[model samples]
Target chain A: MLKKRIIPCLDVKNGRVVKGTNFVDIRDAGDPVDLAKHYDKAGADELVFLDITASHEKRDTMIEVVRQTARDVYIPFTVGGGIKSIDDMRAILRAGADKVSINTPAILNKELITKGAEIFGSQCIVVAIDAKAKGDGSYEAYINGGRVNTGIDVFSWAKEVEKLGAGEILLTSMDRDGTKDGYDLELTRQVSELVGIPVIASGGVGSLEHLYEGLVKGKASAALAASIFHYGTYSVAEAKRFLIDKGVKVRW
Target chain B: MIGIIDYGRGNMSSVEAALKKSGYKFVNTDDIGILATCDGYILPGVGAFKDGMEDLAKRGLDAFLKEVAKTDKPVLGICLGMQLLFDYGEEHGGAKGLGLIKGQVKKLTTSFKIPHMGWNSLELKRESSLLSGIVSGDDFYFVHSFKVVPDDDSVVVATCEYGEEIVAVVECGKIFGAQFHPEKSSDKGLKIINNFGKLVERC
Candidate 1:
């Protein structure tokens, strides 16, 4: 069987790794390239860099960040945030990122997903969904750093993107982010079952048991956490060992 | 110098970076003449099977690739590039491949997931130069929906389990194919590439 992936996400801002609480209160963690190498050594299945930079000049720096990270670390890496077009995807992939994640661009223009998949192949395109629960058994996709609600139902948008040829979905529970309570298992399980593509469950992981829950009960192909790994609460290798002991197969 | 074949698809930067890190000279070229001059070649690409074969055939690199396989010059195909080494594939309306390997590529019948993305441990089938330092249970990054179903089992160098017995690495004479991306698979991955470098150093 395919192994359940334990990914350490680096929320990068200004060439450094940073994380926030419920999408705010951002603070620095470490250098992206340094943190990337750390995670690689720690046995992370993959690494995700959410480039939170906003300036034009910094956009160039973010590309350099990807390049440095790719060179320093030898694992499948993904760069997201500020990616707007196929050309932007091209630059990141050229910088040596194995994949590129899109959220705002995907919500603003669903065609970006289709065009991206066409130009770069669906395997390299990841559609990130920050879904805020609507409290009516439905969730709305949020964009602009979880500040604006797209009003697009998460399930509908996920299915739409799959139809548009997205290879994977990075589904994060906005309400559960930074809670450390656990992943939104109900949401992840529902979404994972709804789509054929692999679903990466992001946001809200507090313990190795939580990782097991996410893989077993949440039904996610991969579990992505920021602070849990960044804060040294658990090394990815330790977490994988925990999962394996719990009868969850993982790549070690 | 190793020639990285540009089939008008996929990214070659990581492959070049890995080759450079391994201390081997490389040139990304579509010119078969330059390719013929190189010690060996690395075929790097990712995408649909039919589209990949079409691009290779369009540039006349399809026959050139087969010709290279005929010689002792090693050819390493990554991901979709690896799939194209087989006879044909069931992906994208059933396309014909280079027919270097005995079998055809078909969509994975595993009950697990599609694409099979993420890292998985390899089960080395037998000894080969490409797996010199690499051992069984070593993890490599894999991302693909279709896998080669070899008619002859002896070609398989390593197998990684993911529902069905997925072929991780295959070596038949001078041609080698990896379903995983060794370039992006961290240190263990580079070790595999380094072994290939040693194989090509003979030329």
Candidate 2:
């Protein structure tokens, strides 16, 4: 009985966490390591630090954050955003990140997925896809943090990455992001069904029921949320309890 | 002291952090002399079985580990490291293991998923020191595409159900192995690490 994962994603910039709404107990909410420790204590199955740093000069800050988090936090965590090359992936993983999530770079150079999986193993490479529903019962892969549309079909991209030896897929629905509506269940289910690897449903989870829907209805192996846990709307423990009561197996 | 064998595997920092948090003194080394000095050794790895075995062999750790298996010093293997304790593995074509235990590793043929990647509950089969203070149904983080099939059933300490009966923990004499990453399983995982640490002290 493999438990469905509950991952709390934190956006990091210049070594500090960004877009974090509230955490009264935490002395430094901006500190990515502190917030990561808080999530680990709160029983997050895993954590994801999306390094949104815009400058290459400050990118090394995320590595420091990963180093501190790995020393302090016990649960597995993934590092994404701004990761472009093999050296970038090696730096993060060597700093103790369990997995490295790549999106735009994977789209720009499909060889990154193949070479990364070959060098670091497939389990270490996670191909994150930001998908936007095209209103025609289809979704297109979006990159550059959802600003640039790759024009690649989401289903075709998902299959391609799997063939390229990706261990997991972090599928985010652009249309549903920040809407608090819910995950695009159709997008999640279609991709999860299209690939043999695990698919993590991300973007637009407003309630515990949405988490349930993402896992049960969306057929996702894991559900990733940010504001729901950060805004204090629902703790990871509470969501796990809700999902467990709803018959979803989650790590306690 | 526990020696964490480092042979260019995926990550050793997580294992080092867990051992430190568990209040144990350890050394990360591939040198057999240094590993021989430690009371117990932890073979921690994350990757393909063929590659992992090759890394161990490159550092002459495969023969050393086999010799350690004959002693009373407790040795624990995690994930791909656990798979290396078997006699053979069917990953990346096929590869020979250290033969520490009587078993063969095979790709998980479960209809559910390929990498069975997530936390899962353990079903205890028998008692062992490695599982001290841990009980049945306790969850551990697992990430792998294969499972070990022990030739002797008595070596299996616990099993987890993942579309089938998957071996989770195994113990034979002083050698133990877990398919899951105890270092990343949080509190309960720390308990297992502490148990192995205490076992080393007693040894």
Candidate 3:
């Protein structure tokens, strides 16, 4: 059976993790390597380090951070944020990142996704979509930390991205993000049903039941949370234990 | 000294860095003479089976590996390198392996996921020095779609359930192959590497 994964996402800037209430008013979390090691020790299925400011910076400092983290922690680590070209993907992978998540660049140039999959194999590329629920009950694709709206339908875009060779979809719900109400179950289920690749539910998750809901109801292969994990509200081992008690096959 | 085969796959620096940090003397080379002189060999590989096999053939390391296997010298294959130890693989149509072990690498047919990329626990099946300090149910990092099905199941050291029981580690005398990358696994991963380093000293 495929075990459901619990991932803690870290947004790194200038080598330190910074968290925000709603992707703004950033506060320093800690060193990425330290946080990553802690997560690894806590039994996190995987760790995601997003260089939120990769495009603004001239050099990719995340590579060094990833290298350091990979040395210290044994779990798989994924790097996202800027990742525009194949060279960026190559450099990160060479730096010891197990997977590379692409967001803005993939939406801008669809070919980059296919190229990444072709050169590095589909398993290495992850397409992260920041989706915002609209007033009409539809979702729109947002990029640059939800600052820019691509005006593309989230469901259509996810299907297209899958067709473009995205190994997995890291779907983030901007509306429910940091709300802690729980994941947008309906949105997650819709996307997961549309795409064949593994869907990692991101953005809104408050408790162990939310993670279970993401896996069981939302049909997400994994659940990623930031505030809950970053604030130490719940450890991955505890979450996995709860999920296991609920009969969810989690890697415990 | 440990010899880590470098055939332009991916991430040889980190592997070398890990070995060096662990206080083990090692070199990354494809040259047969230099590789053969090493106390033990660590075959590390990434990317497709076809490309990896082509690079091994181009460097004439294929026959040399067969000779090393015959000597029963300690050799460890990580990730794609581990896949190459089998008799054949179904990646990119089909490719020939090093034939050190009697097995074939086939794509995972699980509806769960394709890559199976993340941290998963191992279920130890047999006892061996390669897993001396490792415990059953210890999680290890895995990132591959294809797994080895050994002709002789007794050779399997550990297995991980991913829709099916996939062979995680296989040991036949001095030759060992881990489908997961120990250099990339973390603490348990380092312990496995340390065990291999000790094997080098014994050799």
Q: Which candidate number maximizes DockQ?
A: 2
Note the Cα lDDT for every prediction shown: 0.88, 0.90, 0.86
List candidate 3 stretches off by more than 4 Å. Answer: A135-137, B17-22
TM-score sort, best first = 2, 1, 3
Q: Compared with the real two-chain complex, what DockQ does model 2 have?
A: 0.87
Interface RMSD score of candidate 2 = 0.7
Q: A1-252, model 1: which lDDT tens digit per residue?
A: 467888899998878888989978898899989988888888888889898664234588789988887777787888889999888999999888988999988988989999999888888999999999999899999998888988999999999989998999999999989989899999999999999899999888888888888888999999999998888887787888888888998877
- Write model 2 residue lDDT over A26-115, tens digit each, in one string: 222367888899998999999988876543556777888899999999999999988899999999999999999999999999999999
- Model 2 residue runs over 4 Å out of place are A20-29, A54-57
Please give, for residues B1-203, the per-residue lDDT of candidate 2 as tens digits: 89999999979999999999999999999989989999999999988889998988899999898898888999999998899999999987999999989999998989987788999999999999899899998999999889999999999999999989999999988989999999999999999999999999998
Locate the minimum summed-lDDT window of 10 residues in model 1 chain B: B110-119
Interface RMSD, in order shown: 1.5, 0.7, 2.6
lDDT at position B128, candidate 2: 93
Off by over 4 Å in 1: A55-57
Task: Sort the candidates on DockQ, descending order.
Answer: 2, 1, 3
- List the lowest-lDDT window of 10 residues for candidate 1 chain A: A52-61
